[model samples]
Target: MTRPPARPMRADAVRNYERILTAARAAFAEQGSQAPLDDIAQRAGVGNATLYRHFPTRQALLEAVHRDHIEALCRQAKELLAAPSPSEALMSWLKAVVAQGSTARGLAASLMAAIGTQEESWCRDAVFASASALLARAQQAGAVRPDVTVRQLLKLVNAIALATETEPDRDEQVGRLLDLLLDGLRATSTS
Candidate 1:
C-alpha cells in the first residue's frame, strides 16, 4: 500500500532542521564521520533531543550532508548532456565523480559502507543514473566505445580515487590517471 504524504514541519522545527544540517556539515567536515553528536547538537544550538528528532543516526546525518554534493553531480550531468562533445562531457563528469570521492574522504565511504540494494536507496540510484545517462549519450554519439558499461566506468574511476587518495599532489595524479583511462576507452581503439 502507498503511504500518505507526511505533514510539513512547523516554522521552528524547520529552523531546527536547517540548523542541525548546517552544524552536521561543519562537524563532519572538521572531524570526519565520527564527529561527536553532542558537539553537533551544541553547535546547532539545539538539545540532543532536537538533533535526534531531526537525524536519528550518524548515517542519516551523513547522507543528508552528502545529499547536496550528490545533487550537484546529478545536475552537472544534466547540463553536460547538452554539451557539444558527448565524449568530453562524459570524461569531465567522471573526473568530477573522482573529485567527489577523493575530497569527501571518509564521508562518502561511511555512507557507502552502509549502502546496499535497499529499496529506498538515494545515493546509489542518483549516482548511477547520472553516470548512465552520460555514458549512453557518449556511446550513442560513437565517441566512446559501445562496449563500456556504466558499472565498469564507475569501478575504474573509483579505483583511481582510491589509488591517489594518499598522494601529496592528488590533482595531478588523478588527472594523469584519468587521461590514461580515457585513452584506453576511446572509440578509435578496440579492447
Candidate 2:
C-alpha cells in the first residue's frame, strides 16, 4: 500500500506560519485570548490573511499559545530534576511553576479548554511526572510527607498566583506562601 503524498507549504508560507505562532504566543502572554489577531499579524509583519491562513480561529491561536507555554513549563521541570536535593528540586520547580502561572493570566482556563482536544498531552503528563518523581524522592528521604500529591501542590500554587495579584511584592509573597506549603509537606514527628 502507498501512503498519500504530504502537503508541502512554500518557504515563505512556513516562515509566516512560524512568525504568526511567535507573535501569537507573545500577544497571548501579554493580553490573553482577547488579544487581537490583527495586532498579532502586525507584530509578525504578516498580513491578516496570512495569519488566518495559518490559524482560522481565535480558539486555534489560543490553543497554540497554551500548548507552547505548557511545553516550556515541562522543560523547566526537567531542568529542576537535575538539582542536587529532592527538596531543593521540588522547591525550585514549584517556584518556576508559580512564576509561570502568575504571569500567564487566563492560562488555567485556556488549558482546560485544550485538555480534551486532539492535541497531545505530553507536556501536561511530563509536568505531572516530574512533580511526582520529585515528590516521591522527597517522601522517600523523609523531607516531605507521603500524603501530599502533585495535584494538591498544583492547586495551592494556582491559588497563590490568583491571590497575590496587584501586590507590589508578589514574588516575595509567593515565596513566603510556597515556604509555608513546603513546611506543611514536611514529615511530622507524630506521624
Candidate 3:
C-alpha cells in the first residue's frame, strides 16, 4: 500500500498555519474575500499547498477573516472600558466599531448574519455583552438615554456602515453621523 500521502502537517505546520492566517487577514482586509489565495501564500512566504492544506475553501478564508475582525473589535471594546467617561467611551467605541465594520466589502453583511445565528452566536454574545456594559454605564450616567439597546446601536452602526460603503471619506462621515446620533441620545433638559 502506498504510504498515506504525507500524513497531515507535522509539528512545524502549526507555525506555518498561523503565519498564513496572519497574512490572509491582512490581504483580505485590503482586498476583500476575492483577494487571491496565491497572494496570501506569497505574503506568508509559504507554498500554495500549505495555504490550501490549512484553509480548504474560500468560505473558510472568509470566515477566518470575519473571525479575526470580530476578535479585534472585542479587544477594542475591552480597551474602551477603561475610558474616563461613559459617554466618551461609548462614542469612541461606536466609532471604532463602525470603522471596523467598514474595513471590507460585505463584512457588515456577514456580521449581521452571524449576530444572532447559531454559527457564531457565542462570539456575538461576547460582543453584545461588552456593548451592553458600556451602554448601561452611559445610561446610568445620564449621558445616554435609557431606552437605547446594544442591538439598536449595532443596527445603527450597520446602517451607517452600509450607507457610507462607497464614500471616499467613509470613516469621517460615519463619525459625523454617529455624533448626531449620540447627540440625540443625550438627556434633554426641560427648563
Candidate 4:
C-alpha cells in the first residue's frame, strides 16, 4: 500500500520538534508527568511559543514522548528477532518492554491512559503488534507456550514495572521475578 504523504516541515521546525521531545523526556524522567512545560522549553532552548506549537498541552507532550518510546521498543523487538536463540530474543524484548514502560515515573500510567484515546491508540496498537510478532516467532520455535497471548505478556510486563518502581534497591529481585515469569511462558518440552 502507498504511504500517506507527511506534512513537510522546515529544517528549523524539525530541529525544534526533536529538541522539545528530548528535553521533555529528561524532565519527565526527573519529575513525572507533573514536570513544568516552561522548564522543558527552557531546557530545549526553545521559546514557549515554539514548544506549544509542537505540543499544545501537557498530555499532548506526554503522549508524544510515550509514542516515541513505544516506537523504539517496537524497533528493539524487530532487532531481537534476529538473535539466534528465539527464547533469548523474546526474554530480552520482554525486559526491554518493561524498561521502556517504566523509564519515567508516570510513563506506564500515561501509556495505559492512551489505550482508548483516539489520537494515542496508535501507540498502544504499535506496541502490541511488535510484541505479537516476537511472541509468534518464539512460539513457532517451541520456545514459548502456545497458549500464551501477547496481551497477557504485555500486562505481565506492565505489572512488573509497576511493582518495582519504588524499590530500586532490589534490582536483582526484579530480574529473578522477570525470569520466573518467562519460565512460566516456556513450553513444557523446552522447560
Candidate 5:
C-alpha cells in the first residue's frame, strides 16, 4: 500500500528546525561532529527537549549538517552546467568542493567518510553524478584531458583540501594548489 501524504510542518516547527540547523552547523564547524547537543540547543535558543525532538541522536544531527553541505555542492554543480565555458564550470565546482573538504575541522571529513555505508548514501551518488556531468562536459569540449576520471579529479582535490586543512591562509593556499592542479588537468596542445 502507498504511504499517506506527509503534512507540511507548522511555522513554529520550521523556525525551530532552521534555528537548530544553523546552530548545529556553526557548532560542528567550530567543535567538530562531537559538539554537545545541549550547547547546540542553547545556541539555537531552544530547550534540550526541542533539540532532541528535532534530532534524536548526535549522528542524526551530524548527518543533517553534512547532507546540507553535500546538497549545496550538488546544487552548485547543477547551476554551473549552464555556464558557457565547460572548463570554467568544472573548476568552479571543484573549488567549492575543495573548500568543503578543507573545512576547519573533521566535520566534513567525518561525514564524507560515512557515505556508501548501510544508509545507501544518495548524497554520494548525487555528488558523483554532478561531478561526472561537469567533467564529461569539459572533456567533450576538449578543455580537459579525456583520460581524467571523476574519481581522480575528486581525489586530487580532496588531497589539496587535506593539505591545506590547517593553513592559516587557506584561501590563498587552496588557490595556488588549484592552479597547479588546473595546469595538470588542461588538455595539452598537440603541435
Candidate 6:
C-alpha cells in the first residue's frame, strides 16, 4: 500500500519546521545524531511538543536531516551530468558524498547503519540511484574501470570520511584521499 503524500503546512508550521530542521542540523553537527531533542527544541525556540510533532523520534529527525542532504546530492549529480568530463563529474559527486559522511563526528556510523537496515529508505535509494548512474556513465565513457561497483565506491568514500574525521585539516586530507581513490579507479593499462 502506498502512503498518501504529505499535506502542505500552514505558514507558521512551515516556519517551525524550517527552524527545527536548522536547529537539528546544527545540533547533529555538534553533538552527533544522539543530540537531545529538548536541546533542539530550545535551539529552535519551539516547544518540546512542537519538535515531537515534527519528528517523533531521534531516528526520524536523523532521517529528515539525511533526506535533505541526499536530495541535494541527487541534484548535484544531475547538475554534474553537464560537467566537461564524466570522470570529473563522478569524482566530484564522490567528494560530496565523502563530505556528507564526514559532516558530523560520528555521522558516518549512523548513516552506514541506517543504510544497512532501512530496506525501504527512500533517501538511500535515491542516493544509490544517483551514484550508480554516475558510476555507469564514467564506466561507459571508459574513464573508469568497469569492475568497480557502486557499493564498493560508497564504502571507500565512507572509509575516507571515517579516516579523516579527526584530522585538523580534514578537507585537505579528504581531497588527497579522493584523488588517490579516483586514480585507482581509473582505467589502467592492463584493465
lDDT tens readout by residue for model 5, 79-191: 99999999999999999988877654553454445442455555557777999999999999999999999878877876777678778998999999999999999999899
Error of 6 at 41 (Å): 5.0
- Whole-model Cα lDDT per candidate? 0.78, 0.71, 0.74, 0.78, 0.79, 0.79
Which lDDT value does model 1 have at 14?
77
**Ranking 1 against 6 by lDDT, winner:** 6
| Angstrom error at residue 186, model 2 | 1.9
**lDDT measured at residue 67 in model 2 versus the true structure, 0 to 100:** 63
Give the local distance difference test score of model 5: 0.79
**Regions of model 4 farther than 4 Å from truth:** 1-23, 34-59, 66-68, 102-105, 115-120, 189-191
Residue pairs clashing in model 1 are none
Top candidate by TM-score? 6
Worst 10 residues of 4 by lDDT: 1-10
Give per-model CA RMSD. Answer: 4.9, 6.0, 6.9, 5.1, 5.6, 4.6
Ranking by TM-score: 6, 1, 4, 5, 2, 3
Model 4 Cα shift for residue 50 (angstroms): 8.3
TM-score each candidate: 0.74, 0.67, 0.66, 0.69, 0.67, 0.75
Clashes of 2: 0
Pitting candidate 4 against candidate 5, the one with the higher TM-score is 4
lDDT of 4 at 42: 100
- Alpha-carbon RMSD, candidate 2: 6.0
Which pairs, if any, clash in model 6? none
lDDT, residue 161, model 3:
73
Clashes of 6: 0
